[model samples]
Target: MKSEVALLQYSDASLKPPLSPLFIHNDPSSNIEDHPSLSNLNITQQQEQVQQFLKDDWLPITESRNGNAYYAAFHILNSNIGFQLLMLPPAFLTLGWAWASVCLLSAFVWQLYTIFLLVKLHESVPGIRHSRYLFLAITAFGKRLGKVATLFPVIYLSGGTCVMLIITGGGTMKLLFNTLCENKFNAHSLSGAQWFLVFTCVAILIAQLPNLNSMAAISFIGAVTAISYCTLFWTLSVKKGKASGLSYTTSLSKDHSAVAKITDILNAIGTIVLAFRGHNVLLEIQGTLPSNLKETSKETMRRGVTISYILIAMCIFPLAIIGFWAYGNQIHGGLLTAFPLFHRHQITKFSMGAIYVLIIIHCLSSYQVYAMLVFDNLEIKYTSIKNKRCPRLMRTCFRVLFGGLTLFIAVTFPFLPSLSTLLGGMTLVPITYAYPCFMWLAINKPCAKGVVWWFNFALGCLGLLLAALLVVAAVRTLAITGLKANFFKP
Candidate 1:
C-alpha cells in the first residue's frame, strides 16, 4: 500500500489518478507470488497463464505499443475533424452570434477538461490499462450496470458518426461527379444509394490494414485534407466578401411558431455537442503508446491533443466565424452547397470540385478512426469467447458487414440536416459529456457537494437534462422534415 501511494505521488500530474480501491489489489492471475498456499502444479499453471496474458496483449487494438505522439495527433484529427466543421456556421446562424459563440467556446473548454480526466483514468490501475472506453466504464461503475449503460451508447455514438460520414462522403462524390462532368454525367450517374456503397467499399478496404496504428498514413492524409479544405473554403468566402443583404436573424425551418423556434435552438446545441466528439476513443489511442514506471502514456496523449486541438481551432473558428459573416442565414446544408450559388459568377468548377474531393477523402479516413473502436470491441468479445486471437479474414468479413449496414441506413433516409444533430443529442451528449463525469465521480469519490464533486455533478446533470430536451427537439424537427421529403433520397 505504501508502494502504491508512492507510485501515485510519482506519476505525472496530468496523468495522475485518484488512488482507487481497484488499484490496491493485484490480479490473482497475474500475481502468482501473492498466493503462497498454491501447490507446485498450480503455481506452474499460473506461470503459464501469465505468459499467455503477456504474449497476447490484453487489448489487441495494436500489434505493438511503439507509437509516438505524432501518430496519436493524426488519429485525433481524423476522428475530430469532418463535415461537421462546416456546420458550425449554420449552428451560429441558428443560435445567433453571441449565444452561438459562447456555446462553442464553453463547450470546447468543458470537453477539454473532461478529456483530461479521461486521460488520467486510462492507466489508473498500476499494472492494468483501461485501453477501451467500455472497460473503463465497467471498472468505474462495476461490470453489470456499466455494461448496461455504456454498451449500446458507445456503439451508437461511434457507429452513428460513421453513418453520417457515409452520407456526407457519398453525397460529396455525387456532387463531384455531377460538377466535373456537367454535360454528360446525369445520364450514367449512379443513385445516392450506389454512391454510399462506393464510399463503404473504400472504408472496408482501409479497415483491412490490420490495426489502429496501421492507419497512420491514411489518417495523415485525412488530417491534411481537413486543414486544406477548411483553409480553401474560408479563404475563398472571405475573398468573395460579405453578401449584399447579409442578416444574422435565426429561423426554424421556415416556421415562426414558438415550439418550432425552441426546437431549432436545442438541435443547434446538439450539433455543437456532436462536434467535440472523439473522446470515446481517447484511451484507445493512448493504449498504442508504451507505458512504464518512469513515464506514462497520458502525458503523450495530452501533448497530442493539445497540438491537434490547436490545429482544430485554426480550422473551425476561422471557417465558422468568417463563414457566418460571409453567408449568414443563407448558409444551408453547408458552405459547400451554398458557396457555388452565392458566388457562381466568381467561383470556378475547379474550386467546388476540389472541396468535394477533399470532403470525400476526409470522410473515408475519418470513418476508419471512428469505426476502429467498433472493430476493436467486436474483436475483444471474439477473443474472450474463443480464447485465442481472432482469425484475420473472419475479422475482415465482420467489418464489411458492419459497413454495409450503416450504408443501408444512410441511403434509406432522405438525409435531413437535422439527423446528425438528433443523433448527437440522443447518444453523444451522455457518452462525451455526462458519462465521463459520472465515471470520474465513481472512481474518484471526491468530497460530496465539494468543489470537485459538485462541478462534475452539475455538468453530468446538465448533460442529461440537455439531452432530454434535445431529443424532444430533434424528434419534432425530424418529423417535420420527414413529412416534406421522400424516403430513400439523399
Candidate 2:
C-alpha cells in the first residue's frame, strides 16, 4: 500500500506538464513503468492497482462529457465577479492607491498561479480528474487533513458567502425602497432583518433551479450587472471628486493612530482577498467544459481566467482609485452609499436607482452560483438520491431549510462589511491560496531546494499568516462597532 501511494505521487511529479499556454496530448499513465521504484512490480499487477484506484475514486463528471468553453467562461465570471467589487473602493481608502494597486495585482497573479496548481494536480490524479475540491484534498493529504484543512473551509466559505449574499441583496433592496419610495413608505420602518427575509425567499426560489449549467444565463446576467455597476460607481466617484476638489494624494490622515492605520491596512487586505475569492469553484466550472478534447478543460480554464482578469483590471482599479479620491476617510462601507442623497438632480436619482436595481439583479443571480455548491455538498451527505436525481419534495425541503438558516444568520448579524471581511479572512486563505499549493507539494514532492517548491511553500505559509492577521483585525473591527441591531434602530 505504501509503495502504491508512492507510485501515485511519483506519477504526479513526472507527468505534470510545464506551465504553458499550449496543450500537449500526452497520457501520463504510459510512463508509469519508467519509475525506478516500481521496477519489481509486474506490469499486470501495476495496471490492476491503477484501475482499482480509478474505480475507487471515480468522478461523476469526466473529460469526455462536459460543457463548452463559453459556458465555463461565464461560470467563472459569475463566480468571481460579484458584490465584492463594491468593497474594493473602501480597501483603496484603507491602503491608498499605491499599496492597494500592489495588493490587487499581486492577488490577481497569485490566484491565477494557485488555480493552475489545482488544475495540474487534478490532471495528475487518475480517476479523480473531474473531482471536486474536497476530493482533490483527500487525494493529496489523506482523509484526516482533507477534512480538517480542505473540507471545512470549502463548506464554510460556500455557506458563508450565501449569508453575505443575503445581507447584500437585502441591503440593496432596502436602499432601493428608500430611494424610490421617498415619500410613501418609511425605509426605517422596514428593518434590515425583514429585507433579508424577503431576499432569502427570492434566493430560495432561484436556488430551486436544477444544476450549475442551468445557471449559465443567470451567471451571464450577473457578470453584466457586476461590470455595469462597477463602471457606474467609478464614474460617479470621479464626478463627485472633481466637483468637490478632493485630493488624490496617498497620504495618511493626521488624526489616525498607528494602530488604527495598521488595522485599516489589514482590513483592506482582507477585503482584497475576498474580492479574489473564486478559486474554490474553479474545478466545478472546469468540469463544465467539453471532455472530448484532451486540452478542452485546460484551455477553457485559461480563457476564462484571462477574461476574468481583464474584467477585474478594468473595474477594480478605477473604482478603487476614484472612490478613495472622492471620499478619502469619509468613504462609507460601499461606494454607492457614499453618493449624496439630498439635492441630487432627477437624472442622478434615476441613475442611482438603476444602479441599485442592477445590484439586486446581480446579487440574486450570484447567490445561486455559490448556493449550488452548498446544496451539492449537503445533498451528497444527507440524501440517498443518485445520479443527480433527488426527489422534488426532498430537494425543496433542503433548499428552504438551508436558505432559512442563512437568512437567520444574516438577520442576527446584519453587518455586511464586517462579516464579509471576517469570512474572507477566515476561510478564503485555505480555499483559494494555501490548499492548492500544499496539495501540489504533497503530490509532486518537488525538489526541496528548487525555486518552484520554495515558491509554493512560501505562498502557503504567507496565506495562512495573512488569513490569521486579517481575521484578528476583522474581529477587532466588529467588536469596536458592535453588531447591527436585529430589526431596526435609528
Per-residue lDDT of candidate 2, residues 1-490 (tens digit): 0111223333332221211111112233445654444455798966644543332122222212336666666767777777777667677766777788899888878887898887666556432353467767766787567767776678777787888888888988888887788647683457778888888998899888767777778888888888898888777666544435445554457798987778878887878877777778777676655432234356666776777768867887787767676676666666666664411552465787899899898888878878877776655543222423356677688889999999877876666555767777767876887878888999889998699999989999998888889888888888887866544321
lDDT: worst 10-residue window of model 2 = 15-24
Off by over 4 Å in 2: 1-65, 187-190, 239-245, 249-257, 292-296, 340-343, 383-389, 479-490
Please, what is the TM-score per model?
0.88, 0.81
lDDT of each: 0.76, 0.68
Q: On a 0 to 100 scale, what is the lDDT of residue 25 in model 2?
A: 20
Rate residue 101 of model 1 by lDDT: 88
Clashes of each: 0, 5
For all predictions, the C-alpha RMSD in Å is 5.7, 7.2
